[model samples]
Target: MKPVEIAKGVYDVGVIDWNIRDFHGYSTHLGTSYNAFLIVDEKIALIDTVKKGFAEQLLRNISTIIDPGKIDMVISNHTEMDHSGSLPYIMDKIGIQKPLYCSKMGEKNLSRHFSSDLNYQVLKEGDEISLGSKTLTFIETRMLHWPDSMFTYLKEDKILFSSDAFGQHYAGHEEFDDVVGNKIMFHAQKYYANILLLYAPLILKLVEKITKAGLEFNIICPDHGVLWRNPGRIIEAYAKWSKQEDCADKAVIVYDTMWDSTHQMALAVADGLHENGIDVRPMKLRDWDRSDIMTEVLDAKAVIIGSPTLNNGIFPTIADFITYMKGLKPKNKIGAAFGSFGWSGESVKIIEQNLGEMNFDLPVSGLKIPFVPDNNGLEKCREFGSQLAKAIKG
Candidate 1:
């Protein structure tokens, strides 16, 4: 993709990573983009850079609009490799002595990332820099996802170049929120659930602080995915997601079966949930991506997990999913465990212990079946699911 002029004299010179399917651990079925912006004024500034592999492509995109050497300054909003991997090459191309601005933590992280001795200017909260007609104000958003993260606001254009707060791992021809319509919210929610859910408290506080400070934005340019032409939509979403209060009457049943026993139990449980007027999602562990299961877990009021015992422990896939989910620290959820076992029936107890560690409300005791769950055992599973539904409704 060529350089897109997001605003007058401001270009999105980032490279789209259309082939990337996995971001660290999160699934990017639609791929993603590494967005970098170039602001041209009497003094030109480049905000962030693409990944290391795309350094030449970033320079080429910048050259399409202006010579890379003409860029007077480079801004490091975050020290993550995806956004700052090309810093060394960019500085070499522009000038070794050019000013590179970043947060105090950003400077430290960049120094650690690269051994080169480059110009590093540290900025704090409420710091402002002049770029000819445009004035950029810095807002420190530490731990929004990273310690080095910050936001650069172009006062003249009312555009907030957010580092990664409202980003989605999606790559497509559409570059703006208005063009993608409501479909983009799913990707954004998935990103939050998988990446930022652990920092929900911080996000709520940050949004409140920004609101009280009377900061306004006409556009929000994140380092990934489409730009938000209507910034309020995303701001409102962040507020809601951060709160984690608006959960639906939905249950996600995740299970892995060795002899189709746990699978049948999962289906029976789903039926029970649906009969009780609860939306249910029965996901087979091997069939669904962990990231996708987490996305479903975000808005679910209850999470029911089932797995067959193996080697006196829960299934390996079940353990993997539990680790992933616990690390995200989902809130306001009711959890239950169920499984089938031949001799050592420890999977349900192990799952229950893990859920307890996450502080999930275990409304019902775990259900365990021996060998294959006969009709009576399946009925017991359905009753367990119904009991969980009642707890969720309460």
Candidate 2:
């Protein structure tokens, strides 16, 4: 993709990562883009840079509008490799002495990431810089996802160069919200669920702070995916997601079966959840990506997990999913565990313990079946599911 002029004299000179499928364990099935912006003024500034190996492409994109050497300074919104990997090459090309502006933490982080000798200028909250006619204000959004993350607001354009707050792992032809239509929200939601769900409390506080500050944005340019031309939609979504409310009557049944016994139990549980007018999604861990399961878990009021016991422990896949889910810290959930076992049945108990650790409301005791669940055992599974529905409704 060529450089897209998002606003007058401001261009999105980022490189598209069309083949990336996994982003630090988060599934990027639709691929993703490493978005970098170039603001051309009397003093040109480049905000962020693409991933490693894409530095030449990033420079090529910049060269389309202006020479890379003409860029007077570089802004590091985030220190993550995906956003700052090209900094060394870029700084060397532009000029070793060119200023590299970033937040205080960003300054520290960049030093750890690369050479400490680079011209580092630390910007704090409410710091402003002049790019000739355009004015850029900085907002310190520490731990929004990373300690070094920050937002650069172009006051003249009403555009917020958000580092990763409202980003999606999507690399498509559509570059703007209005052009991508409503489907972009899925990727955004998935991104939020898998990457930012653990920071719900911080996100809520950040949104409130931004609201009180009366910060209005005409466009939100994230470090990945499409730029939000309809900024209100993404903001509203962030507000809703950050709350982590279980307003939707949905349940996700995630399971991994060894001998099809746990799979049978999962279906019976889904039947019970469905009978009570609840939307049910039965996902096999082996078939569905952990990231996708998390997306379903985002709005679901209940998360029912089933796994067959192996060597007196939970299935490996089950354990993997649990670890992944635990780190994300999903909130406001009713959790239930069920499984089949031939000898010592520890899977259900292990899952319950994990759920308890996550603060999930375990409304019903775990259901465990011996070897294969008989007709009566399956009925118990349905009953267990029905009880979960009642608890969710209550």
TM-score of each: 0.99, 0.98
> What are the per-residue Cα lDDT tens digits for candidate 2 across 1-394?
9999999999999989889888988888889999999999999999999899999999999988998999999999999999998899999999989999999999999999899989999999999999899999999998989999999999999999999999999999888989999999999999999989889898889888999999889999999999999998998898888888845999999999999999999999999999998899999999999999999999889999999999999999999999999999988899999999998999999999999999999999999999888999999999988999999898
lDDT of 1 by residue, 283-344 (tens): 99899999999999999999999999999999999999999998899998899999999999
Over 4 Å off, model 1:
none
Q: What is the lDDT of candidate 1?
A: 0.93
Give Cα-based local distance difference scores for all models: 0.93, 0.93
Error of 1 at 48 (Å): 0.4
Counted clashes in each candidate structure: 0, 0
Model 2: residues >4 Å from true position, as ranges? none
